[model samples]
Target: MDVPAGVLGRLRGICLGLPEAYEEVAWVGVRWRVRTRTFAHVLTVEGGRPAAFARAAGTEGPCTILTFRSEGPELDVLRRSGPPFFGPPWGPEVVGMVLGPNIDWNEVAELITESFCARAPMTLTRQVERPPG
Candidate 1:
């Protein structure tokens, strides 16, 4: 319960707000999916990042990693944002953001929404506001 429920709840709402969205626990945390395809994954590791990820990250675990779907230019922007956002292990098309009290829920929601849109089918994607360009 160290992490704020508000933060988690906000993320949950944004993800599940999408069409056919659902939640499942895995990788020691919860992941939101559209049908069977995961768009956002949240995990708080108590012992630094997992070994596999640490290699690429060059950092230990004990961090909250929230990975989401992102494409080239947009993905580049997130990775460049620094601190809270970074590249996840072995994923060219995804980004992982560190979660904490200082995190911006609005920005988080936008990222998760885009992630959902990217993974969800056209029929489902059409349901959301489509955010901004």
Candidate 2:
């Protein structure tokens, strides 16, 4: 699929200073990055098979949207606020399903960037975290 480059470019501008890679993931194109110590990716899954169209937020971190699919109300709000960020309109439930703690656009970008900055070299990192204590 011809994923939009504008979206990926926007993400690149948002998180500079990281090495980015564009590759075919899950049958779709994804942009991934690594910052010497961390990795991050971002993409969109369209059609039946969940394709990945990601933009790397950082090096050494899991990409955005891919990691924000399993959270809670925080994601619900994001789903409701779709468009420009999410692209197209989906019902509350559809939005919730696609955009969550590990799969939404905004949270995905933020999470990927943070994880890339914090992850240690060669250490397996947990992409998502529980609500702050």
Candidate 3:
């Protein structure tokens, strides 16, 4: 299944809003990156094509998955949330979120921002105006 246009548009806005962030077509899907480091990636997982992602999402059917960098308490919280949230088979800091109806766009934006910060250099990350926790 293709990723919804609205969801991609929203992700584009959030990621491109960051300093020095750029979007590109990744091997399987689209990814937003800071320099050479990928901060966020969105792709369709189906038929266990990408076995790791399929296993991570716990599904063989089609699903839109967004993977991003996250850490600390926020990462821990998401990992415990289940379903829409899961641990992608990547680095320690990588988190996978299943996109669908009833998604919290505000939360998605925040997570993308955090993902940017995680991958961006201090020079660029300093430019982001993150909300108070």
Candidate 4:
């Protein structure tokens, strides 16, 4: 379950707005942020189980923390067996599919980068509010 360094670098470069962390071994995690706010986190490697969490911006607050499965079928079984976590409406769910088994690491990295960009706040421009009379 080891991803190449070059792949990781490309992903990070695309997400310069956020900080991405890879290769934490058993507890490897990737955190996506906007300026200083956290938008999402992916637990790439875990010794105990397979799970992940994502956070969306412009919401009431931090989401309830939806759980996602990695490696396809394994995650499916985990969900069916009454796991502590559940899936969230983070994406089309095709991400894990493209990454795992399919061996499409490049596509996976690109998808992740796109997701981060969509989640991250606009680095330019500001919300214009009209002055109350």
- What lDDT does the true structure give each of the candidates? 0.77, 0.38, 0.88, 0.37
Compose the digit string of candidate 2's lDDT tens values, residues 27-93.
3444444433224344554442232222121122132343322224544564456432331232232
Instruction: Provide the lDDT at 6 for model 1.
Output: 64
- Which lDDT tens digits does candidate 4 get at residues 1-133? 3334454454455445333322222244454455554333444332322333322211221222222224346435533443233434455332232123334445444444444444445542122121232
1 versus 4: better TM-score goes to: 1
The lDDT ranking, best first, is 3, 1, 2, 4
lDDT of 3 by residue, 101-129 (tens): 89999989989899899889999989999
lDDT of 3: 0.88
Q: Score residue 84 of candidate 2 by CA lDDT.
A: 23
For residues 5-37, could you state the per-residue lDDT of candidate 1 as single tens digits?
Answer: 666687788887888999887765788998889
For model 4, what is the alpha-carbon lDDT of residue 101? 31
Candidate 1 TM-score to native: 0.85
Judging by TM-score, tell me the better candidate of 1 and 2.
Answer: 1
Which candidate number would show the highest lDDT if scored against the true structure? 3
Alpha-carbon shift of residue 48 in model 3 (angstroms) = 2.5
TM values, all candidates: 0.85, 0.38, 0.93, 0.35
Q: Estimate the TM-score for candidate 4.
A: 0.35
Candidate 4: Cα lDDT at 10: 47
The 10 consecutive residues of candidate 3 with the worst lDDT sum are 1-10
Model 4 local distance difference test score:
0.37
Worst 10 residues of 4 by lDDT: 57-66
Return the lDDT, model 3, position 54.
90
